[model samples]
Target: MGFKPSNKSLLLEEILDALGQLTESLSWEIGTTNLDNQTEFRALELLWWLDTSNYWTTLYDTINIGTSYSQETIQHFFWDLTHLISRYLGLEISHYTAHPEKVAEVFWPILTNHSEPIEIRTSALNMLMMSQPTVSRFLTLYWFMQAEPSQQMYNFYYTTINSMANSKYPCYDKYRKIAAQIVRFVQHKWHHWSTGNYLLDYEEPMRGYGGIVQAILMANQRTGFPSVLRLTLVRQVV
Candidate 1:
């Protein structure tokens, strides 16, 4: 059948059904298949009920439900579903006048959790970094120590720092100004990444200074990496 807007009450009912099904699917041998279609459909249905009282609650229920949560899946959900969810949030902000902070509550945690897959955490890191100052220094340090940071990880951290520096925080220059303390924190703590796509050959990685703008600016000063920063960074955030 063709698409038709459900009555508000009916919409709520449909959303509930979908949420139940998604949660059920995630818990079983079913969810791993057709994720693309499932997430797109899931996101669309959620937005249709944005004004309903449990709009965020329903979404959170899906995320927090203990039976099926994992960093890899959560990360996949973001990369797969952020387009839908972020747009939904954007619509809520513009049309529904929803609060960004409410959205951030859910968004930041998923990104900062190093235990989660790198892609999702990277996406979340960029999301919070672009819209707010919510990166977890501890998480960043933890990941850097674990293994090589991906292009995704490097860009997210670097851009986050740069954006903060250019913003109201004038003390951003003080980030790396602490001598090599910050550098050592990253070098000693973070996994030494080998991908030429994310890191520059400069004295330190873009994240070394604490913001991405500084990273890009310094990056501009040298041929640090050949990949497009926006392609590497913004799509994940936006």
Candidate 2:
């Protein structure tokens, strides 16, 4: 006996719901690292296969539909969902597709939207920067300069600059001067505090400062500067 259409649809829904639950569980269990067993790796491999086999069509469709949602809650949900997916995928969506420009088209609005949370904007910005580093270079630099000085923003800034520093592309050369200016601005603006030893003792703030120094040194090396010269420059700035 053949199954009815509604029965088949219900069965498919159950299967999808099960897959969603499995995905969520694996995400919480594995996170971005610490794969302790073969089972976890196999589960991740399966999910990766599914996402690639569909060429991220499900993700693209979800973003397209979610973008049209007028409710704030629904929009926020999509933002978080996309952010998680982006984190899990690691590589930019363009790497998995032929038409890479389309990746930028979808993410640009999210990155440019001021109302979006900084975290969401940064995620979108990272994806765009990875997909088209040269095209987005100026915008990324602009974002670093314009964004309010905070640990979160600084962390994102460090991530962007560090990636550019390590890249084989020459995009980091022209921006070296701008990067130096940004470092100086950040130091003068944010580190002009009177409290010295007390504030320096805080682990989080110190880590942030370390990140800034590391990023500056990397950027300096990209400019063909010697390590000693870079360290001296970092000392002067940081």
Candidate 3:
């Protein structure tokens, strides 16, 4: 080698070059002069490599807070990188179940925040529901129940609850407990109606009442059932 740069100098140079390259790479615009489609593809290639390589820690570290990047830059790259990683892995939101901490740190925020894409949020919630003890699934239902109702989310939570309550995996006793929890939780969260009305509001308050009643009925249809849940029908008095 006639003249080679030192490893230290090369590494420093590479870090700065990566920052600039990644920034341009994230955008969709492709210029014919300096940057083209090839440039953008190359940037993604670099990101894929770094994500799989040993230097990923260094790569994320370089972009996260307290680094040389500006707050705006850090936030932009952080979200873009997160979305990129999530997409790379088959949109498998349940993958985070292995890292439960990530459910709160990552998926929960996306699921609860209305600003995120609906598909992404729904997928995240669906995966979360898949990884459960009936209690955890109930909690997930509680969280989504608290959100402004969307038909899709409403249906998803209902279907998930029904499946869990009806499934034989939880045993009769455990299943009863889950159904009781659902009834109690639904009643407490939505106690604005009479004891025997069964109307579907089609709007917010009584929207999911049918599902809750169904759960209660299913729960009581068992041997040795304990005390019945006395929740009122959330129908509007006409």
Candidate 4:
């Protein structure tokens, strides 16, 4: 048989070649636990420092003043990183849950905050909320209450769930459990989110926001292939 690549010697030239390949791999879609496991929290600490290093700075300088990576690249990176998280969830969720900050901060805020795309935001929130007990229910309710929700949004969410009902992934069950917890948790806080000083008119919340909860719950139990986790919302919650 021909020689295998990994079996090659680690001489000075060989070592450098290996590192070159490794660096190239990091930019591509690859699964890695070293950043989260072996290094523990220190890994991200260093990554943040690197994100600001001369490398990214040089890259930042190269881009046009108003240019940004295309939406496809951004989405690809998101999906790749998400798959890494899913692989580690069984091993790290409990630990990451206890120490939320253990997760890389650079990505956490983007995922938790509502400023980003709903799909991305929802995914991160789902993961983070899954570990936070009943607290997330009220939190989502709080944000939901404060925001000016739309009728179109309500239909969109309901439609998302109805669509998921036909899914085949086991993770869907896990999603449903999470959605149910949020709903039950928010039942007591629901009335507080409405306006007490409205003068003219107000829309019924059940007809608006209430439908979203139902749809989200249903979508959670909708299953899919292991590679494509049904964590569109969880990725947002990350």
Best by TM-score: 1
lDDT (C-alpha, whole model) for all candidates: 0.42, 0.40, 0.42, 0.34
Query: lDDT at 64 for candidate 1?
Result: 49
- Writing each residue's lDDT as its tens digit, candidate 3 over 4-100 gives 3346545445545656665555442232334533333333334443332334344445554223444334434444444344345432333334445
How high is the lDDT of residue 218 in model 1?
14
Model 4 TM-score is 0.31
- Higher-lDDT candidate of 1 and 4: 1
Candidate 3 clash pair list: none
Q: After best superposition, candidate 2 residue 128: deviation in angstroms?
A: 1.8
- Per-residue accuracy of model 4 over 148-232 as CA lDDT, tens digit each: 2432223333333323333323334454554444444232222211111111112344544211111222111123111122322
Name the regions of candidate 3 deviating beyond 4 angstroms.
1-95, 131-137, 143-147, 167-238
Clashes of each: 13, 0, 0, 21
Give one digit per residue, the lDDT tens place, for model 1 in 103-220: 4665666655656555445545544433422244434543553463454466446444433433433333344233223333443223213211131222233444322222321122
Where does the lowest 10-residue lDDT sum fall in candidate 2?
A: 193-202
Worst lDDT run of 10 residues, candidate 3, spans 192-201
Estimate the TM-score for candidate 1.
0.47
